[model samples]
Target chain A: MDTEPALFSILRQGQVLVASVHTALDDSQLLRLQRDLVGRVGTDRARGIIIDVAALDVLDSFGSKTLRDIAEIARLRGALTVIVGIQPDVAQAMVELGIGTGAVATALDLEEGMAHLAAALGPAWTP
Target chain B: MPGLTYDAGVGAAVVDSGADGPPEPSAAELHLLVTRVVRARVGNHPAAEDLVQETVARVLAASDRIDGGIEAYAVTTARNVIATMWRDEARFQRYQPRMVDLDEPDAPDMGVLAGEDQVAVRRALESLSVQERSLLLAHEVDGTSLATLAAREGTTAGALGAQLRRLRARMRAEYLIVASHREPPTERCRPVLVAVALRDQRRWREAGVDDHLAGCDFCADVAGPLLESSQQDSGRVAIDVAKDHDVVEARVAVRRLAADLGFDRSDVTLVATVVSEIARNIVKFAERGRMTFEPARSRPGIRIVARDRGPGIEDVELAMRDGYTTYGGLGLGLPGARRIMDEFDIESVPGRGTTITMTRYRKDTR
Candidate 1:
């Protein structure tokens, strides 16, 4: 049997919501992630959302599209979304595959992404 | 579009020569005839019904009395319309000659089910015991490592490997028996495994195993998927990149194609990125071009070819450099694309055109 990790883990950094995805997900998991994030955004009252994909090894077309869609959905709920921690190989692959992550803002790492989110959320957010 | 194969003049001569010509077909009859004509040529394409409606409109517009039968007249008009559409489409083609070889090797028969054969495999798999099914699924679909499985089963890795081999042979034997409905000699059962393992290997040809597979129903049933799967593995998608929006269409097609070919998420994104880069180049440097996505013949990967008949590259080496760009790009398009794919090649002739071919293989599949 293929052992699957938890689809994603959510951390609350003040008003910011950081989702650290650790597994390469199939369609069902992506849908679950979308639904979970949307629901969490409502209850958590997050002003900003940072998706950390540092542990992810790949980001196929479907995965890329799902991320884009997740960002769009979060934006609709009035939270700024930033995708951080794209590996070098993953970034190169993304460029070669012609899948532009144009919809979501991307950062090099979690810290940079959180900084961007902190700036966007304003003086209330220090971390 | 190589879609239309109908011989437009099939029944026209008979209608023209028949004395007093056949009775004029009614509007409803004409609609049916034109629909059949278009469908026969183009199958159930989205444009088929529209072509039939246009044919009906044309028939309505004809003021002069028809000499031949209405069926023949409508058929001729439909053919003319289809031909004109093809001609117009041909004019928009920007790729010179359209296709460049990506090294097509004789595909091996690996007992992988494809198309209708998949149904047979599915039924055969259902007949397997739960444990046997799980073993196969864990190894093949789930991609569980042999070492890990061996550790879990409390057996040496070598023993597990041998056990798996035996299980595969038995499973394939049962699959063959179930699929072909033939009871072969007991000796023939083990040969099925040998036949499957060598299906893609060149040695199978020298050993006369392919010929054996051709004659043996059991072997053929087990190997049918290999034949069709390899065929499906190779395909080309040509996208016309004349406008910025067309790039999206091209990207969508590439992404779908990559996904269908069973590329992992990272690889799919890589394919999409390469396709987009080439397509964006078409929009930028050439103003128009074609991007083709095909399978790499020698390995488990996709081959992408981007060709344009615009002003060719002046410096090949400069274009490949990380920050080099003729059209003020970020200078990373070609280099980034090259870095992502497993193999990359480019050819260009000044004033003629350019062709960039790249391939990305699945590492885990290898």
Candidate 2:
């Protein structure tokens, strides 16, 4: 109802489609965005989803677990998810909360994350 | 927002008596708002109620500003009142009595005082050297610090300081190592001991001992007990392993005792492995066995003595050999246990029983 509480933008690097999430992406919003990205890419070609959480000040257990779940689901859908901008305190809190972030590939910033995703997806993965 | 009533009798009071002004929040609304405010402030219900009542009284005095959103206004007012109450409570606690005399001579307070005395003794001994410990004992206990220590040890102020520093560092290190092994120390102790040991170790080797002693408090607390236990004779543990369950229990018990002795997890694992093999042998060959966990006198290690009343092995030399086993597998238990442990001894009679005594020194001790 509130436009799903987050902003989503799609960018293209010569047919390589990258869905960039630029707001506080919670569980439901993440799921919705994933579905929308999968629909846009049509599953025939590989796609990359880059979740930018730079604006987030707090990352509780539910948020971290949801991100992990999103990564797993994206892999199953033949799309790779790169989570970026995890702050040090948020990482520490996640460890203290016993939230396992082992599944997802994390990067310092969105640019690096995109680079990593691009490298993992290879040159032919471009749409 | 305009249907409000003013009660001039209750010290400049304002009440939202207007029919449209949210119907003047009911008793239930007031109770819920106050309860939330109190819980957030004091963390206890009864104390929260007292603070809430005070806030309500304050609100009643200045109720003239009662507007449309009365619930939000009441919550803000309650928060301010609780904040003021907390400050006053903290101020009162600051000047509270440190000691209370309850007229009884021998009570729990005396035990508290004894605890305080122990702390004081530890604090005093914390900065003394082994020489200083001996010196203090000689001076205070034997009344010989003035001229006798000076004559016997050639005591000068500078020499005394150096000796005291060394002594203090050793005791501190030993205390710290023992403390660190049990549980991580508090934030305050960790930094202080770290600074002291780091600075002291730069000058002396004994001072460096503090860094190694940084973990287990159980070992630190029982250092004296361990020494006393080692000094005493005729204190041997007798183990009887007559059943399979006994073997398992003995292995678990030895592992636990190793932990109680403040052995690190790796050492505990090794000892547990050796004890398991020995225990299994007793069950398979001897039918029954017993094991004892004792402190070794000559060495800084734990001695595990296991015995079984079964058909004893005919060849002691063959059993000690690395690949010699009648019960299959790699047959590395006896030899492996011997190699891993510091000392190992096995004694078996042809048809009576066998006793194997093994000792594993603590890591720091080794």
Candidate 3:
């Protein structure tokens, strides 16, 4: 009788898609995110993806790796991707575990991440 | 002693208390009950039986104040005593390095400098310059700070770090080359070889050793023990968890154990990561805990037990939820650990503590 809530909520701002993740995703959720992103990017033709992860309490190795892969795949599709809002404890654990989010651009929060995208994309960019 | 073993009869008789004006449970009854509780909580621990004995003594000492039934009182007392034991063990494990089973051929054999290995190391070290050899020995064997050594040598810490990193890599490479060929290295090379051998044992940190080894194929060939030639069973590894470093140590021990049990590279990493998550929780929440790795009794697998006396989980079902965190922590730890491991069990009592048991079977081996 009850259905699970969506794991991520996407809002398109001009040429960018700001996907705010609301839960810790498992393998199936990750696949869903990937599929949704592909469908959205195909229709909207977004040039930038900002993944907001402020609600995420933990980013285990698998989750971290998946995010990085998502960023890589987005780049291949001509979209710049940035991750924002890593909690302090999660960051500490990731460093100690030697689980680096390799080559993934990161920002302190959604605002800063948008700033980064706007600056990188130049004056023609709109958020 | 023979009569005391009849705890079941005593318990049964006590059930009909109204018929005899509620006779109190005897010391033997309390002892048996407390022993069962302690043993169930601290399975396979050498101190479990001793802890039960101590609990019974403590309960009897305060027998007068027990308002509730003696069985309930004894169980509560036993739980408190176990918490204190876990706290003490955590403090002790923090100061002491864990003992690992490196004697097995498949163990993480940090090459010992003995016999032919010693001879090769000696020859290798002698090849290095006097200054280089002393620096290696002072840092690796003597346990001197690189900063102090650098001050004496008139170099900055950054420069010294770089120099030592390069020096260690070169020495290890030379030692491995000489060691593989069965040739006694020149005198200039002896001390360097000994330094490499010592670093291999993890007696002290060798700057950039892992990085250098990763890039160098020759050193990789000769660096690790030729354990593939000798098949041996891995004995039990016990890691005391008190801090983040201890968590890392526990993970390394698990990885080695998985390797010893012939798990593939990715499986080894998965097992190690699971250990890391569980051990981290122990340190983060409990400030101390213990992890033990041994052969599972029911199957061909490595069984791991993680026990902590931190504030217990109030809602295990909710905690099992992936994003649930009562302390604003990454809720991913418990759920993530469960996903990685083949088997996971968690037990927690509010105001008491928590224990997690997990096992990863060598399915291929079985």
Computed on C-alphas against the true complex, the DockQ of each candidate is: 0.09, 0.01, 0.02
| Residues B1-366, model 1: lDDT tens digits | 011112234422111223354455545556778889999987887888888878877865662455445567789999998887777667767554556666776456534445437765776678668877787788878999989888887888888777676566556545655566556644754455444543334444354443344234455556555444433433655565667656667767777878877887766766666676677777777776767666678877787877776688899888888767665445667887877778889888887677888888876765
Which CAPRI tier for candidate 3? incorrect
Q: Report i-RMS for every model.
A: 8.7, 19.6, 12.2
Q: For residues B68-183, write the lDDT of model 3, one tens digit per residue.
A: 47778789889999999999989889866646554657434445435668766886688688988898899999999978988999988789877777677666656576778744
- Estimate TM-scores for all models: 0.35, 0.28, 0.32
Q: Model 2: per-residue lDDT, tens digit, B1-366?
A: 443343434433344366543467544456567678778767875677777767666655555566456677778988888778778878878856645675667876889877766665675575566666777667556766455566677667567655555555455544654443444344434333433443432432343222222222333343333223432442433345555445546655676677777887656656765676677687778765556677677755788877665678899888878767785534656776777678888888887777787898998998
Range of the 10 consecutive residues with the lowest summed lDDT in candidate 2 chain B: B207-216
Give per-residue lDDT, candidate 1, residue B33.
Answer: 87
Sequence-dependent TM-score of model 1: 0.35
Backbone clash count for every predicted candidate, in the order shown: 15, 31, 19
Ranking by lDDT: 3, 1, 2
Displacement of the residue B183 alpha carbon in candidate 2, Å: 50
Candidate 2, B225: how far from true, in Å?
24
